[model samples]
Every structure is written in structure tokens, then in C-alpha cells.
Target chain A: MTLIMVVDDDLDLAEMLGIVLTGAGYEVDLVNRGDEVMPLFSTQNPDLILLDVMLPGLSGVEVCKLIREKSMVPIVMLSAKDDKQDVVAGLEAGADDYMVKPFDPAELVARMKVRLRRSGGEVNSDLTIGNIVIDQIEHSIIRDGRIIALTRLEFDLLVALAKEPGRVFSREELLSQVWGYRPATDTRLVNVHIQRLRSKVEIDPENPAIILTVRGVGYKAGVPGSFQ
Target chain B: MNSPFKAWRTSLVIRVTGTIVLLSIILIYLAGSALYTQISSGIFDEKLNLSISDAQSTARNAQFQLTFSQYQDKAALKSIFAEILAVPPKTFDNTAREVAIFSFAKTKVRFKFSGASNFLEVTSIPKDFRKKTKISNTTQWGRAKLSYINGRNEPAIVVGHTLKIAGAGNYEFYVLFSLEQQTRTMALILNYLWLTGIALTFLIGIITFFVLRRLISPIRDAARVAEELTAGNLELRMDINGEDEIARLGYSFNEMAVALQQQISRLENLSKLQQRFVADVSHELRTPLTTIRMASQVIYSARDIFEPKVARSAELLVSQIERFESLLRDLLEVSRFDAQAAVLEIGEVDLTALVKETIDYVHPSQDRIILLLAPITPVIVDIDPRRIKRILRNLISNAMDHRDGKNIEVQIKESENEVSIGVRDYGLGFTYTDKKLLFERFWRADTSRARSTGGTGLGLSIALEDAKLHQGEIDVWGERGRGAHFVLTIPKFAGGSIRSRPISAQPE
Candidate 1:
């Protein structure tokens, strides 16, 4: 059974989420306030986190940052605001994905399933893009013999791009393939995550050598020493 | 471009100034003519008086000298005449003196003594003056031309007198006075008058322009500051100097500005409060509504076990709640727009994909009657993706709802500065007047119709507002039974305005 921890400010919505998740064959642990999230989080070690952006004690973005400091937990932000700032801020704060208010329950579960699934797991391999070496098995990037930190979404984005180095990945392609999004899902998600990835892997983010942008198209991996 | 002359044609200041200049020119011309006539008459009067006196004295002296000669021989008379003529006529510089003695036409003479004495050339007198002098033998004086033997001309006054000589019989004596000095003086006076008049007029024009501009500067500044204040720069105020009437006006205007600022800020605070209340109500209601939705869905899942009527009621309840939720969302969005708090997060995206997605969302069935059209390459544009998606979604969904089982065509086109998407539906179209009210909130094409498949009724209005936010436009055209077309034109890049609409409302 999949254990999903749901943190929300409203008691009834938390209970409702628990009911909905339980009915979907998932064990749900309901937490009402944001401050109570970590204590329950450590012991339970839920596979996924359904966090609300606006909370009474600590904001969902802050909790996401705190959780990101310790583990690579898959965190999904639940927000009433579909506004870009809130969504991007949550993503930048280390949320894997987000769902706006009044979202369908079935869709939410499908998003969670996508977040928890691991890629390149059956066959552990090391991938290199530009100067950075990506260890899929270890879930880390080594550049200049130093390990760099990356959010889960950024890691997935990089892995997806690196796996198909020859293919030119358009924003829509990255969105659908990596983010598990349908067409017309906000393209800002792919762009923000790509920027986050470059800052982590590339020697100079201002002049990205790892993810080379194709003019009038999308992005592709740099050919060997083309960056030089 | 407005022509400079045409710009002045409608200006009150130019018209008034032109009228003033024309009237002053007319009045000045009248005064100048009168002054010229008076000066000329006075000068001629002084000239005539001096000329007549000088001529009379010379004539008397010549007659006395001739009468005193006793020998009466021609030689003696001629010598006396020469002596009398040798005394040049004492006259002003402008007066030329000349003397002519002519015997009466009927006067006889001694055979050897017919020599007549004339002191000056007869050509010194004008032919016209000589004709009048010939007609009237009495002493006469008038202005005439005096021409010397050298052919020099001077305006002169001729005064003639008749004398009777002892042996020579009747004689005519005349004096011609030159008016050269008077003419020079009159020319100098005319030059001075012209310079003075021109200088005075120029001075008046300059002084008037500056004085009028000085008086008008405060008003112009007041108008500028007032315009700035109206533009919402409430801190603006007219620059005040010494406490003249204009300064007093500034003081009063500042007072009004303060009042206006206070009133506007007060109203602004009130509006903010109202918006906050609406947002709070929406948030507070939505949380509970979400719980209700979940509960109702759970109940709806097990509806097969319940009675048919109860199951139908449960289904209806679920659908109505979803409708209520969409309405609440739209209302909140509209309120946010009203507060001018809507923000854009811009990114580059292919609009082709967005349109396809919207069509799928509207009609999930594979046999959708809608057609998606695009260019060979991606129609990429920079914009706030979420807003564009919402707009596209609203327009496509509305088309599908009204398509009335007919095919719908969605077209995408682009230009350098703008992009347009036209959604054409071959459905029950609208009337001419319906287009005007199409974007009104909660308006329906037919009131008797059912709620139209879970629409919030604010979709088109919200779409229009969204388009307006991006400095875009949504053009609509519809006929009774022909079809309906809606085209949304936006700039190709964020923060740009649409200059060329790739597609128009008219059918291709």
C-alpha cells in the first residue's frame, strides 16, 4: 500500500483528502498544521507528501524547503492559487509538483504515482553531460569531482534530457515525458526546472554548456567539447 | 501631420491676436494719412508767405530804379535795369529768385530803342504758371517749376508784378522761388516718421507678446499640474511665487487637490476592503466545498445501491456543486482583475499545442467536430502560458457548447508583432445586437435554455479581460444561421501590443 502524508490547514479538507486517498487504495496520514509535518514525517516516512501552500503556522513552501534539506522526498504542493508566482516559488522551494484547488481527486492520485516512480532503476548507470557526471543509481551529480545538489524534478529533467542526447527536446516534449503533463500544461514548469538544472550541472549557468538551446526550437545536449 | 497654419486656424489666441493686429493696422493708416496732410499744409503755408513777401519787395525795387533813370535813352534804362537786377532777391534757401520784364503785347517802341530788360530766364517759370501769369496781368504768385538754363529743376513759387516804364512803356516783373530745401526737410521728416512708427509698432508687439505670455504662464502651468493630478500623480502642485491673484489661484487649486486626494484614497481603501472580503469569502467557501465534493463523490460512487430517484438526485447534486465551484472561481478571478492585481509570468511556448489541448479538454471524444489548424512549423510565442491557456480554453469550450452538432474550425496565424486564433463554429449564430452584449457577465443568448453544460456564464467576459491584460483583442462576428467566429489577437512577445492581426473575424 502507498503511504501518502497529507498536510493541510483545514481539518475537514484533510479528512476529506484522507477519505479520498484511502478509497484510492492508499494509506493516508493526515496532518492539520504545517508545524506538525516534520515530526510525523520522519517516523512514518511516507512515500509521497501532499502539502498545502497556505497554512496556519508555516507555509507549505517553507516546509518543502525544510524537507528538501534532509531527504529526496517527492512533495506535491496543493494550492488555492494557480498564480505563477506561488507555483514557481513552490517549485523553486523544492516541491516536485503542484495541483490547484478544486482539482479532481483521481488526477491528483495519478500525479502522485508519476512522482514516486523511479527512472533508470532496473539498470544502474552513470551518464555524463558536458563536464558533469550523473549517477542515476546514487541519485547525485558529480562535477569537477564534487557532488552538487538538485531537486527531484530537476534531476528527472536532466536524466530525461541526458538519456536522449541526440533528440532535440522541445518544452512540450520535456513537459509530457518528464513532468507527466498533458499538452498545454504550463510550459513555465519545464523552463524553471531547466534553469535549475543548468545552475546545478553546468560550469557556468550564464553560458550553459550542458543544455544547449536550439534557436527557434528547444534544448539539446552539447556535443563533446563543443562547449570549449 | 497637422499643418502649422491649420494648427493656428482653430486656436483662439491666434485668431484674437490676428484680429487685433489687423484693426491696429487700419487705425494707424488713418492716423498716418491725417498727420501727413496736416504737416504738408503747414509747411506749404510758411513757404508761400515768405515767397510772396520776398517777390513783392524785389519787384518794387526794380520799378523804382527804372523810374529814377532820367535820360530815358535805351542805354541808360538798360544800365539802371542791370543795376536793379544786380541786387539779388533776398529770400529763404528754398526760394529761388528770378526776374522777367515783358512789354505789353500792344506797346509800340522807338525804331532803335525796342530793347526790353529781363533779369532772369523765362524758362525758370512753369508753362502752366506762365499761362496763368499771362492771363492775369495783376501781381500773382503760385507754386511752379523753375528750370535754369542748365536744365536744373526746383519746385518754386512764382510771383509776378506789372510795371509801366517811361520810354519802354508797359512791363511785367516776376520772381521764382526754389523749394529744394523744403523738399529735403520734408524727406528727412518722412524718414524719421517711418523709422519711429516702425520701431514703436515693433516695441508694442514685443511688449504685448511677453506680457501676455507672462500672464498666461501661470494658467498654462495650472493646466499642466491639473492634468498631472488627474493622471493620479496626486503629489503634483503648481509652482507658486509672490502672492498675486495667480498665486491665490494656486493656493485654492492646491486645496482642491488635497481634498481630491483624500477622497480618492478613501474610496481606494473602501474598494480594497471589499475585494479582500470577497477573496476571503471565496477561500473560506471553497475549502468546505472541496470537502462536500469529496463526500458527494463518495456517495455518488455507491449510488447504484440506492433507489433510482435518490441516485439521480445524488448525480444532480454532484454536478451542481461542480458548477457552483467554477462560478466561485470565476468570480474571484474577476474580482482580482478589478483590483488590478492580476500578474503575468511570461514564458515561450507553442500555441499550437495549447489549442490542441484546449480542443481535447472541451470535447474528449475522438470524434470531435472541431478541426485544429496550424502552420507547418510551431507557432511559438512569448506570453503568460496559464492566462493564454485559460483564454484558449474558454473560447474553445464556448464554441463546442454552441456548435449544435456542426463542425468547428480553429485556425492559428501569426505575424511579426501579433498572433491571432479564430474559432469558427457552424452553429446557431447570434443577432446583430447580441454581439454588443456578448461579453457582458452572466448574459445568455437564450434565457430559456438550460445552464449550458456547467458553464459559469462569465467565460467570455473573463476571456476578454484576460486578452485586455495582455494588450490583446478578441474580435467576434456572427450571423443568424450562417455561423459564428471569434478571433483572439495578441502580440507575439510579452509586453508588446498587437499591430497586425494574423487572422480576422471574417471567414477566409
Candidate 2:
């Protein structure tokens, strides 16, 4: 069974979320405080985390950074604020996705399902973009015979762009393709994640060669040896 | 800074000073002319009196000398006349004197003499004065010019007298007194008068200007302080110096400023408190509302096992919760605007695509009701997409509420620096009087009628605010029994202004 950790300051909201997640056929572990997340996370090893932004003793963004230090587990932040500062801060702290309060439960389940999905049945293929090689079977990328780690969402984003090298994927398209969002929803997710991915994978994050941005349109994967 | 002439229109100091200086100039001119006339006439009369008395004495001496020489022969007489003609000319100590002697036409003398002293022309005296002298007994005096043989002339007073001799007929003797000294004195007096008049007038002007400026500086300070206060600098106050009328004015002005600042800050604190309450209420309600919504959704999903009435009630519960959530969201947005905490997340977007998406989102039934007329190519704009989308949604939803089975048209057009989105409906239109109140919060055209859509009554008001945040304007036109049209125009770039609107709210 897939176990998901729900961290929220409100006990009722946490319990409600547990009920919802349990009903969605996922094993749920409820944690009311952000500080208690790490000890249980180390032992239980949950497949995903649903963290709230405002928490006692530890902020959700700070917890997100702490979690990123140890693992690349999928983190979807739950925030009461739709403010760009709060959302972007959570994203920059290594949250893979976020949902504002009063979000649809069905949509939340759909997003969690996408995050928990594994590519076990697909044929293993090697994809090349810019000067990097993506190993589907190993779930990693290699540059100059060295492996680099990526978050699950980042890997999915790069795979989406690499699968169609000639196509320019708009922000809306990327949001729907990788984040399981409806078309024409929040594009800031795509933008922030792309920046994070470039910083981690590119030789110079300022001038990205792997993710080439098309002005007024979208982004695309760079061909091998495109840059000198 | 205003121009001098323009300041004359707006500044009290300049106008008052100019008026006082001009009146002083006229007053000085009148006083100076009156003084000059009185002093000049007095000096001329004194010089005339002296000339008349001196000529009387000299005429008497000449008559006495001629009487004694009346018994002499022709040679003796000639010597006597020569001595008289050879009298020493006047020096500086004496007034300039010249004499002329002529025989009357009635004289029956053997020797008819006509001679002058010092080459003085005999015709220097006026013929009218000579005629009066010839007929008069006492000395006849008049003003004349003493002309010399060298063509030089001097203004003088001439006194004519008749002379009697024993052996000679009656002779006419005239004496001329020069007026050059008196003329120079009068000119000097005039120069002094002019200097004094000019100096006094300038002094009066300068004094008036300084006094007015001294008196007006406080008012000017009050004006400046008032302007600063009006510009939102509530701390400024007039500077008071003394317990005079101006100081009283300053006191009153400062007191008013203090009162105003207190009132403003009080109102500000109250408004802040109210916004805080609203925000807190919204936030506090959100968590519980979220829990309740999930619980209701859980119940709604299992409604198949319940009775029909319970199922229907569960369905209504879920839908009402959704509506309540949207209302809470809108209330928060309004409070954010009230607190001035709303900020834009600007991006470049395809406006045509955004409109199409909104049209499909709002009325997705696909009955071909909403017709969109836009450019085939993309109309790209820089804006906050969420706010723009909300505005479009509100307008379209509003149209759908009042559309009344008519076709609704959404048009997009662009100009050089601006773009417009116009939503028009031919339905239960509003009256012309309601146009002003269209964007007002909670305002409905006909309050008696039931609302056809699920709206929080803050849509149009929030839409106007959202448009204003982007430096945009929404134009509306409506007529009873006709239709309603709303047009929103915004700039193409962030921080830009709408120079021209691509569409008007009025229908063709």
C-alpha cells in the first residue's frame, strides 16, 4: 500500500485529509506538527508528503528544505494563502507542487496519483538532450560518466521536453503534462520548476542549454552538442 | 514658479505692491508740480522788484545830470552825452545793465541822437512797451530780450523813462536788467525738486513693498503648509512668530491641521481594524469551511446508499459549499484591495486565447450563444492573467445572467498601445440611470427580481478595482428594453496607459 504523510497544524483538517486520502485507497499517517515530520519520515519512509505552510515549531518551507537534504521525495504543499510570495517560497524550498486551500479533493487525489506513479512497465530507453544522457531504467542522468540526481517532477518535466525535441511546449501545456493540472491554470509552477531544473542540471544555470525558452511561446529541449 | 504677469493675477502681494507704487507715482507728480510752480513764481517776482527799483534810481541820476548840462553848447552837450554813454558796464556784483537813448519823434532839436551803451541794440525793447512808455508819465516796465550787435540775447526786464533837457527836445531812456541769474536759480530749484520727488517716490514704493511682503509672508507660509497638508504631508504646520493678527491666523491654521491629522489617523486606524477583521474572519472561516466541504463531499459521494431526499440534500450541501467558498474568496480579494495589499503578477499572455478560454469556461454548454469576434492572429499583452481572467469571467457571467435568450458577443480589438475587450448582450437591459451604479457593490438593477446566477454581489466592483490596478478603464452603456454593453480597455505593456480604446461601449 502507498503510504502518504499529511502534516498540518489543524487536527481536524489533518484528520479530514487522512479520511479523504484513505478513502482514495492510500495509507495515511497524520502528523499535526511540522517538527514531528522528520522522525516519522525516517522510520515510516512514506512515498509522498502533504505539508501545510503554517505550522508550529517548524515552518513548512523550512521543513521542505530539511527534507530535500535527505531525500528527493515528492512534496506537495498545502497553503491557505494564494499569495505569490508564499507559494513561490515553498516552491523554491523544494516543494514539487502546491495547492491553495479549498481545493477540489478529486483534483488533489489525481495530482497525488500522478506523483506516486512509477514507470516500471515501460521499455527502458536512453534519451539525449544537450550534453546529458537520461537513463530511464536507472531513473537518473549522466554527464561525463557521472550521475546527477533529480526530483521526480524534474525528471518527468525533462522527459516530457525530451520526448518531443521539435515541439515547443507552452507553459499551459507543461502544467497539464507534468503537474497534472487543468490547461490554463497556474503557470508559475512550470516556471519555478524549470528554473530549479536548470540550476541542478545545466553547467551554467544563467544561460540554460538543456531547456531552451521560446519567447512568447514556451520551452523546448536542446539538441546534443548545440552549444560549443 | 509662475511668470511675473501671471503672478500679478494670482499673488496678492505683487498686486497690492504694484497698485501702491502706481498711486504713489501719481501723488508725487502732483505734489512736485504744485511745489515747483509756487517756488518758481516767488523767485521771478523778487527779481522783478529789484530790477524795477534799481532802474528808478539810475533814471533819476541820468535826469539830474542832463538838467545841469542844458545850458552848455553843442560841444559841451556832446561831452556830457559821451560821459553818460561811457558809464562803466556792470560787474558781477551788480546786475547786468545796458542803456539806450532815443529822441522822440516830436523833438525839434538840432542834433537828433539815437545811441546805446555797450553796443546794445536799440530795438531790443518791444515796440509795444515803447509805445506805452511814450504815452506814460511814470516809468513803464516790461519784459524784454537784450540783443547785442553780435547776435547774443539775454532775457531781461526793461524799464523806460522820459528825460527832460534845457536846450534839447525830450529824450527816451531805457534800462535792461539781465535775468540769467534768476533763470539759473529757478533751474537749480527745479533739479532739486525733481530729485526729491523721484527719491521719495522710490522710497515709498520700496517701503510699501517690504511692508506688504512682511505682512504677507505668514499667509504665504500658511498657503504652503495648506498645500503640503493637501498633498498628504499631514505633519506640516504654519510657523507662528508673535501674538498679532497673523499669528492668530497661524494659530487657527495649525489647530485645524492638528485636528485634521487626528481625524485622518483615527479614520485610518479604524479602517485598518475593519480590514483586519475582514481578513481574519475570511482566513478563520477558510479552514473550517475546507473541512466541512471535504466532509460534505465524502457524504455526497456515498449518497447512493441513502434515501432520495437525503441524496438531494447532500447534493445541495456540496453545491452550496462551493458557492460559499467562492464568496469567501471574493471577500478576501476585496479586503486585500481595501488594504492596498493587492499586487500584480505580470506576464505576457495571448489575450485572444485567454478570452476564448474564458468564454468556454463561463458558458461551456455550447449552444452557440457566446459569439467571439477577435483577430485571427494572437493579440499579445502584458498583464496579470489571474485578475484579467477574473474580470472576463465576471463580465461574461453577468451577461449570461441578463442575456434573456439573445446572443452574447465578446469582441477583442487592439490599438497601438491599448487593447479592448467588449462584452455585449441583447437582453433585459438596465436603465440609463443605473449605468452610474452598475459597478457599485451589491447594486442590482431590479432588486425585486431573483438573481439568475450564483454571484456574491461583489463581482462588478471587484472587476473595476482589478481593471484600475492595471491602469485600465471599463466603459458601460445600457438602455432599458435594449441591451447592455461593457468594454474594458487596458494598456499593452505593464505600467503603460491607455491612450486609445479599441472598442466603445455604445452599440452601432
Candidate 3:
């Protein structure tokens, strides 16, 4: 069974989330304070983390960074404030996705399912995008005969791009495809994640080649075997 | 040159200085001419008096010599006349004087003598002046141009007197004093007067310019500071130094700035606090709302196991909660606009595609209600898509509410700088006066009618605010039972103003 960790300072809301997640057939671990997340997270080794931006002991963004330093677990942040700066700050701290407060429980569960799904059962396990080769079975990318580690979200994003080499995917399409979001919403998520992905994969992140951006459209995978 | 003319037209200092210089020039010219005329006329009068007196004495000497001399025939008389004429012309230091003698026409003597010194032309004296001199008998003088045989001319005072001789007939004696010296003096004086006048005028102009500029500098500073203040530099102020009138102006200006800045900052603080309170309220309410929402959903999921009435109540609870949540969202948006805190998240978007997507989102049915008119190619514009989409959704939903089962027409048009989206409904239209109150929050056309749709009542107001944030506008046209048209015009670029709206609210 997949396990999920929920972190929030508000005990009632955390408990409520626990009840909802358990009802959704996922085993749940509830942590009230942001500072207490790591110890329980290490022991539980949950598949995903549900973090609240405001916490008592430590801020959610700081905790997010600390978690990112140690693991590649998917994190979806819950923010009470929908200010652009707050949302952007949470995303920049290495969160995979974010939902404003008072979100529908069914929708939250749907997003968590997308984040927890394993990339398996592909017809072709190996794919080439530009000079990088994505090994789906191994769940890694090989660049210049060396393996490059990527978070599961980045991996899914890259695979989605490589799956259709010639297709240009809009930000909305990528959000629905990679993040399982319905009723296409904010594009900042796709923008920030693209930057983060380029920083990890591209030789020169300033000018990206592996995932080329199409002006006024979206992004596309660079042709295989092309030298930049 | 054009820029300077524009500056002259706009700047107070330049205009004042130019006017002062022009007036000073006119005044200096008048005074200089008056002074020149006085000095020149006085010099000519003094020279005329001296010439007449000198000719009187010479004419008396010649008459006495002719009366005392003894002459028997015309030869002795000629010798006597030659001796008298042998007196040398006056030297240059005294004045360039010449003498001429002519026998009277009525003389009875046979031998008539006529001679002039220095080759002076006899015709140099005017006939009118000669006649006056002959009739007056005393020395008479007038101004004349003394001409010589060599075609040289000098301004002179010609004096004449009648001479009596013993044997020779009556003769006319004349003395001409050259006025070249006086003319040169007058010319030099005139040059000095002109130089002084011009220099004085220039000096006055420079002085006035500097003085006025000095006086106006503080005012200019105040103007510049005012501009900066208007441009949002509230800290700017005039620099005050002393206690003169101008300095007092500076002090007062600075005081006004301080007061204005303090008032603005106070208002800004109050606005910020209000925004903070609104944000805090929204945030605090959201957490509990999430909990309640989840609790309701949990109960809603288990509604099938409950009584029919309870089940129905659960369904209503769920739907009303959704409505309440939207109302809260709209309230927060309204407060944000009130605090002027709304910001644009700009991006390049294909407007036609966005419009089509919005139409699909608002009305998913295939009843052919909305007919879209758009360009063949995509219309790309820079805008905050989220806000724009919200505005479109509001307008389209408004039309849908009043569409009265008739087909709705949605059109998109573009200009060089702006793009417009229009939604027209052919349904139960509003009154001409109702258009004014349409964008008001919570305003309904018919308060008696039960609204079938779940509108927050703040949708149109929020849409208007959203358009204003983009420096855009929404115009409404409606009449009783004639349907309604709503058009939103926005700039194609961020921070650009709409010009020449491609779609007008009034339909053709």
C-alpha cells in the first residue's frame, strides 16, 4: 500500500486530511509541525508528502528545501495565501505541485494519485532526446555514458516530452499530462519546473537544447542525435 | 530652432526676459535720438552765430579800405580790389573760411570785378540766400554746402554783407565757414551715443535675465519637485536657504510638500493595513473552510446510506458550499481591487484560441447558442490570461443569463494597438438606464425575478475592475427588449493604452 505524509500546524485540518486520505484508500501519516516531519518521514518513508505553507516550528518552504536535500520524494504544497509571491516561493523551494487552500478533497486525491503513480509498463523502455538517453525501466537518464539523477516529476516531464518527439505540448497540456491537473490553471508550475529541469539536465541551462521552447506555443523535445 | 521656440513659449523666464529686452531697446532708441538731436542742433547754432559776426567785420574793413584809397581809373581800382582780395584764407584751426566778392548788378561803373578765394564756386551760395542777404544789408547767414571747382563739397555756414566803394560799384562780400569739423564731432558723439545705448540696453537685458532667473529658480525647482511628486517621488522638496520673498516661497513650497507626503504616506499605510486585514481574513477563513469542505464531502459521499431527505440536504449542502466558496473568492478579489493591489501576470497568448476555450468552458452543450466570429489566423496579444479569462467568463455568463433561449453572437476584432471581444445576447434585454447600474456590485436588473443561475452578483463588477487594471475598458449597450451587447477593449501590449477600439458596444 502507498503511504502519504501530511504536515500542517493546524491539528484539526491535519486530522481532517488524514481522514480524507485514509478514506481514499491510501495509508496516511499525520504530522502537526513542520519540524517533526523529517523523523517520521525517515521511518515511514512515505511515497509522497502533503505540506502546509504555514507551520508552527518551521516554515513549509524551509522544510521543503531540507527534504529536497535528502530525498527526491514528491511534495505538493498547500497554501492558504494565493499571492503570486507565495505560490512562486513554494514552487521555487522544490515543490512538485501546489494547491490553494479550501481545495476540493476529490481533486487533492486525484493530484496525489498522479504524483504517486509509478512510470511503468512502457512499450519502449529506452528513449533518446537530443544527446540524452532516457531509460524508463532503470528510471534514469544517461548523458555522455554517465547516469544523471532526476526527481520523479522531472523524469515524468522529460518522458512526456520524449514520448512524442515532434509534438509541441502547451503548458496546459503538460500540466494535465504530467501533473494530472484538470481545468487547466496556472502556467507558473510548468515554467518553474522547466527551469529546474534545465538546470539539472542541460549543459548550458541559459540556452536549453534538450527541451526547446517554441515561441508563443509551448515546448518540444530536441531532435535525437543533434549536436548543439 | 523649433525646440527653442517651444521653450520660449513654455518657459516663464525666457518669455519675461525677451519682453524686457524688447521694451528696453525701444526706450534706449528714443532717448538716444533725443540726446543726439539736442547736441547736434546746439553746435550748428553756435557756428552760425560766429560765421555771421566774422563776415560783418570783414565787410566793414573792405568798405573802409575802398573809401580811404585814391583811384583815378579802372586799372587803379582793379589793383585796390586785388590787394583786398590778397588777404589769405582763414587757417584750418580757426575754421576753413573762404571769401568771395561780386560787383552788384545795378552798379554804374564800367569796370566790374568779381573774384573768390580758394577757387570757391560762386554758385555754392543759393540764389534765395543771396537775395535775402542783399535786401537785409546787415550780415545774413544760412547753412549751405560749399562746393569747389574740383567737385569737393563741405557742409558750411555762408555769411554775406553789402560793401560800398569810392569809384568801384557796390560789391557783395561773403565768408563761408566749413562745418566739416563740427560734422566729424557730431558723428563721433553719435557713435558714442549709439555704442552707449546699445551697451546699456545689453547690460540691462543681461541684468534682468539674471535677476529674473535668480528669482525664478526656486519656483522652477518647486515645479520640478511637483512633477517628481506627481510621478511618485514623494520625498522630493524645494531647497530653502534664506528669508527673502523668494526664499519664503521656497519655505512654503517645502512645507506643502512635507504635508502632502505625510498625508499620502498615512493614506498608504491605512490602505496597506486594510489589505493586510483582508488577506489575513481570507487566509484564516480558508483553513477552516478546507476542513469543513472535506467534512461535508465525506458526509456527502455517504449520503446514499442516509434518509432521502438527509440525502437531498447533503446534496444541497455540497452545492451551496461550492457557491459560498465562490462568493468568498469574489469578495477577496473585490477587496484586492479596492486596495489597488491587483497585478498583471503578463504573457503572450493566442486570443482567438483563448476565446474559444472560454466559450467551451462556459457552455459545453452543443445547442449552437454561441456563434463565434474571429479572424482566420490567430490573434496574439500580451495580457494576463487569468484575469482576461475571468473577464470573458463573466461577460459570457452574463449573456447566457439573459440570452432568453436565443442564439448569442461572440466576436473578436483587433487593431494595431488594441483588441476587442464583444458578446451580444438577443434576449430579455435591460433598460437604457439599467446599463449604468449593470457593473455595480450585487445590482440586479429585476429584483423580483428569481435568478436561475448561481451568479455571485459581483462578477460584472470584478470584470470591470480587471479591465481597468489592464488600462482597458468595458462598454455596455442595451435597451428594453432589444438585447444587450458588452465589449471589452484591451491593449495588445502590456502597459499600453487602448486606441481605436476594433469593436464598439453599439452594434451596426
TM-scores of chain A across candidates = 0.91, 0.98, 0.97
Q: How many residue pairs clash in all the candidates, one count each?
A: 4, 0, 0
Tens digits of lDDT, candidate 3, B215-291 = 88888888899999999998887888888898888888889989999999999998899899988999999999999
- Can you tell me the CAPRI class of model 1? medium
Name model 2 segments beyond 4 Å from true.
A83-85, A113-178, A183-228, B71-97, B100-154, B159-173, B196-218, B236-252, B302-308, B335-357, B364-384, B411-420, B432-437, B440-450, B468-473, B489-504
Strongest candidate by lDDT: 3
Model 2, backbone clash pairs (residues 3+ apart or across chains), number: 0
What Cα-based lDDT does every candidate model obtain?
0.80, 0.88, 0.89
- Indicate the docking level reached by candidate 3: high
Q: Worst 10-residue stretch by lDDT in candidate 1 chain A?
A: A219-228
List the candidate 3 regions with Cα displacement exceeding 4 Å. Answer: A224-228, B86-95, B106-114, B166-168, B448-450
Q: Model 3 Cα displacement at B130 (Å)?
A: 1.3
Error of 2 at B20 (Å): 3.2
Cα error, residue B236 of model 2, in Å, equals 4.2
* CA error at residue B291 for candidate 1, angstroms: 2.5
Q: Each candidate's interface RMSD, rounded to one decimal?
A: 2.0, 1.2, 0.5
User: List-wise, what DockQ does each model earn?
Assistant: 0.50, 0.60, 0.89
Provide the lowest-lDDT 10-residue window in model 2 chain A: A116-125
lDDT measured at residue B362 in model 1 versus the true structure, 0 to 100: 77
